[model samples]
Target chain A: MLAVGLLGLILLSVIALFHSLLASTSKSNDMTVATAMAQQRLNELVTQQPSYRATYGQDFPTDVLGQAVYAHDSQSTSTFYSQARPELLKDDGPAFGRTYYLEVQVFWNTPDANQVAANRHQQGAQSVKAGRVVYVPGS
Target chain B: MKRGFSLLELCVSLGILSFVLLGIFGVFELGQSSFHFASLRQGLQSEARVAFYALGNDLRHSSFVTVTTVPRTVSVILPRQESRGNQTLDRDGLCTAGVENWESPGAIDIHSGFPNFDSFVVYYGTSEPEGRLIRQVVRPALVGPYPNAEFSLVNSMHDNPLANSSRVGVTRTLSKRLLSFRARRDNDSRLVVVLLRLRGMGGAKPGTGARADETFELTLKTYPENTYPRV
Candidate 1:
């Protein structure tokens, strides 16, 4: 009986470790997806700089530029999304030339939310826990 | 004397230990997941700051004169102001009442005044999902006559959405999820404003709840009008 009990405890610990690994893997995947979305958008914004400058003047307005615009061509349709504000902090020191700022944000659902309720009910008295993913451009 | 416990008793104790171990492991995994999430949140804030700074640099140079006048309220330097004294005469032909309207040159009205003068209206063109696009019309004073008239169309920071050929190497935005974009001339003649939001929740249609959902504030300043002596 003692031998059997010890073996069972060992199995439980192994199972717990396996579960933690799986959760981490899932979170990593979600983060990659969000990052890809953000990077692609950032590249597009940079490319459109010249024309956007001509249309909106040298000084672009956040309220006017940050809003969504649905534009289409013969080949396909694309949405031009812009951040409400720039994505970076400015330096107090003066610099030459005009520079345009671009910022991208990526968000994903938390893995914890899906399992929180189940864990909570099963524990009954114990505190339940969970996890999520969010991505920003700079850091 | 006999063995401390029988095999049967030992087995029962082992089963209890296993149950407790499993519970503990579950809790540990939960903590790991939470940490990953926190990393992502911090990343978002950092990216927003980078974008704001890049744009601000350009706005600081919007003025024509490095030190034309002290920075003040918009009203003080308005292109048109009521005359401070008599409207009768001034050394310069400019109206004695106030500064002459820089845009009064009939033929060159659009291009005169400021160098590379462009309208400041914000526009959301049909483009991509979660995208913010703007178009401005600029008039340059250097007129060469005929085909190359002074007036020209330019894109804001983002490229032009409507392009017939890819020759320009302009890529079309894949989404339209722009939020709020506001700008104003700063005391230094630089364009200063903050963008409140951009990008929708996800695969949301334009104007839908997801599409309009943006929660970031990015302030940027660029394009200072140069100060030029009046005629």
Candidate 2:
């Protein structure tokens, strides 16, 4: 009876370890793919050279990155924003703006909210986050 | 201690031992698969970094840049090795290749117009899915006639490649398992966005990701500092 109980305990511990290992591997792989997605977005935006007046408030896809059938335990997607800060700008050209500051943020287990809250007290979190930025002329 | 008489103890012990062995073997299989993926990802990551270094170095110093669609090659016009001291670069971009009548060889070697020939570096792959990336430097022929052939040099290198094959100076292969290399010229940013995908030689093993999805991809936009500085 003692031997049986000890074996059962050991088996449970082993199962728990394997579960954690699988979760960790999935997280690592998701993080890597999310990073690559963020990089692709940044380069595409820079190459497009979006004008501030045109794309200032528009999202690239207007939707979340859809989960594939193979994706399990984690979800992934990315979004981009275009803004112009006079203080950050070397020279703020005009009212319409000649320069744009573009940012792309990738999230695995992405946040639920589409827009970031203005209230500081609001809590929104993501387990995995990666981002890239570039400055381009707003044509 | 019932002298090998109890069958219950023997059966129970054998069952536990079998369970332990099964668990160990399962872990071993999982470990093997994990190790394979980790190594594959690491190898591809390192190769991508090396390719980035080569592309970045050439793009940063480019005097002009050209990209082709079909085979997907990037050709950069780089200024020839500047003449040291009083040495003048001849039509072949070598001080010792042969002196042209226009070059005095020791008179400051300054030209009123742009020099006829500049060093060219072309980055191209062999073919799709299993291509090897190649970078070649070409210095044009001595005493060739186009006085202003900045675009013409690359034109000939692309159109009549056989005729200009002899002009190729050095060729270096970057990667062996390149799946695709794409470059898009962003005229607004004056930067080229380059994308490279590398795959492993063998087929993907039993894994979570499919073989087609196992490729490692890298993308970046780079502008020529020499060509667009303060412009």
Candidate 3:
């Protein structure tokens, strides 16, 4: 009976180790996808004309690269940008130019949402952000 | 009569139990190492992504982009705050000269009384072994042509201490464990592509045998929008 108990304990430990490894792998994959999607959005934003971009709203309409955009959550803020240096905007010197600060945040759902929530008091979604400044040449 | 096992039976069982325990331990060690390696690789990739986005944004918005062969540098001329008083002035040469003349100018003419242009440069620093990737920004300063005060300012920023100082616009280490850093302008001279190779530091623990020296290579490209006026 003692031998059987020892064998069972060893098996349980091995199973737990494998489970953790799998979870890590899954999280890594999710992060990669999120980063790529965020980059794509930023690239799109930079390519658009300044007039068109000024009309952008808070949320992006379509899904980004097949991943559903996370709903607004308290854990993180969505994509947005403000004037990095508002004082510079008021300058009427020879260097006066239009610069817009931009940021894009992307998030995706993870497979272990339930398990993570049960173990830790948090959601299972992973998120990444890409931010940069956009410059418009004076006409 | 059979209450206890004979000595021979006891010896055989002991041998089998020891072998089983050893096998289990070996498997556990392997699993641990694999987990560590995976985690390290993920971390490296995450760092690379952050560095790329930070640099790419600046490149895409820069008004001028220069890739100097010597010292292997990527310098970007960020947009400057134009004088509100000269909003109607033709200082950019767009109004005085036609589009053709504006495009043919050998060098950008910096009109006086205009605010200086800020710049950002990325290069490898003096960090030993695998050097660190350094990003240095020079605040608006009186600069002449291509290699002017701004260029010197950027070089000085690189050589200066990493701590925040008034003279230094903004200097920071972009990433560490950089085995190599290279930058070049595309054939059209419109895009700048940066290549970086990073390796993990420190060897795995003696017994864990985990992979501690994994290397990751990342390439990033960006097109500066306003470097050249659209004909």
Please tell me which predicted candidate would have the highest lDDT against the true structure.
Answer: 3
Give all TM-scores, in the order shown: 0.31, 0.57, 0.51
lDDT of 2 by residue, A40-130 (tens): 4554454444443366453232333432212222122233222211213343454334333444555534234344311211123322333
Q: Once superposed on the true structure, which residue ranges of model 3 sit more than 4 Å away at CA? A: A1-139, B66-115, B119-121, B125-127, B140-147, B157-166, B187-189, B201-212
Q: Please, what are the lDDT tens digits per residue for candidate 3 over residues A17-97?
A: 665664665456445545655564565555543434335532122323332321111123222211111112232333554
- For each candidate, how many residue pairs have backbone atoms clashing (under 3 Å)? 106, 0, 13
Name the top TM-score candidate: 2
Instruction: List candidate 2 stretches off by more than 4 Å.
Output: A1-104, A108-139, B5-12, B64-112, B115-118, B138-164, B167-172, B201-213, B228-231
* C-alpha positional error of residue B166 in candidate 3 after TM-score superposition, expressed in Å: 9.1
lDDT of 3 by residue, B133-202 (tens): 6665543344333444434422442333454232444566766755556665555434565665555643
TM-score, candidate 1, is 0.31
- Residue B72, candidate 2: alpha-carbon lDDT: 36
Better of 1 and 2 by lDDT: 2
Alpha-carbon lDDT, every model: 0.33, 0.46, 0.47
Sequence-dependent TM-score of model 2: 0.57
Please give, for residues B1-231, the per-residue lDDT of candidate 1 as tens digits: 776988998998788777666655554554444333333323433444343443333333333232111111111211111333222210100000011133554323344432332222222222223234332222333433222343222222333434322112223331233333443333432223333233323122211213211233333333333323310
